[model samples]
Target: MSVETDKIEIAFEQLVDIQNTIDTVLKVPKNPGHIGVRDMLRIIIGPQTDSDQEKLSEISSNFLARRQFKALLKSQTLASQTKQAAASSKTTSGQVRRSGDDFDLNLIPSTGDDKLFYMQLKVKNHERFAQISKAEMLFVESKGVFSSVPLPEILDGVSQIMIRQGHPVLDAFHDPEAEFFIK
Candidate 1:
């Protein structure tokens, strides 16, 4: 998906640039029962363009066409993927049971560059989840020890797994060589 957005400060003689911006935005999705593209164009142009009706109409048509084209492309891609997945549906019993190991946090990489990390966790209760947010002890070599790191900092480090997968989590912000873990 490609989106081209351009903005300019309020000015005279460059009314066409504002029209072009409106023309390009007509490609936004339409659903959930809200305002139409024309109304949105009016909102963007009315206060800034001195109520120019002819320019508004031109901008509206261009933007609407672009939006429809993008929506059509997205719908086609989704339909193709759904069709492909439906055509492959075979499974083995042991293969399915062994898949549980994929979620094990202990299997995550724990070394290199101090930027890569991997961790997996299974939370059984809300209090456990809160404890994760309040992680104060370092889990290294299968033993827990009390530490002095703040709760928010610990949560931020744990959140990195969602952003980057297959990287070892490092402890440069805490102790450089200590291994950190969460349940």
Candidate 2:
């Protein structure tokens, strides 16, 4: 076989070994709830001396750094796509108009005459609102004026406003408690 083919085979074998090591480490009863890369590496390498543990730690750090770099690249791609889509949809009139089918407006609160004033504010200024961050919105919603409204109702109103204003309505931040796991 060519040198390139041999290198590929070696890489595949290493990947299989790593996977088996991960499986074995996960099966250990003494392992912590959240396992760091070093912990996993130490478990796999079975370090007998201080020097061995230090070497394993260095290797784990490099592995984690590479993984983080890859994750950043993926996140950048997604962010770029989202930005491009948002920019392309913009009109000269300064208003973003999305087709009803593009997003589910019904996912958020319904704004009627009887709705709370704060809910109306959320519905009106979904984009460029004072409480832009999710944590800030949650804190604000916990107060007396906004407290009466359910969190979902507030989020729905906010989401509707955001969708109308041509901003990305990240459901993860809006309703974190919702089960999104695939069955």
lDDT of 1: 0.31
RMSD per model, one decimal = 24.2, 21.0
Give candidate 1's total backbone clashes. Answer: 7
What is the number of residue pairs that collide in model 2?
2
Give the distance in Å from residue 25's predicted Cα in candidate 1 to where it truly belongs.
90
lDDT of 1 at 128: 42
lDDT of 2: 0.31
Q: What is the C-alpha lDDT profile of model 2 across 1-183, one tens digit per residue?
A: 699999999999999999999999888586233445554333232333345334333433464533442333233221111111222233454323322211211233326444312212232333523332221211111001111111233354343222231221322223322111100
Residues 94-182 of candidate 1 have per-residue lDDT tens digits of: 11110111111222333555544343333223434554444332222101221111112344324323213321222211222332333
TM-scores for candidates 1 onward, in order: 0.19, 0.16
Tell me the TM-score of model 1.
0.19
lDDT of 2 at 44: 32
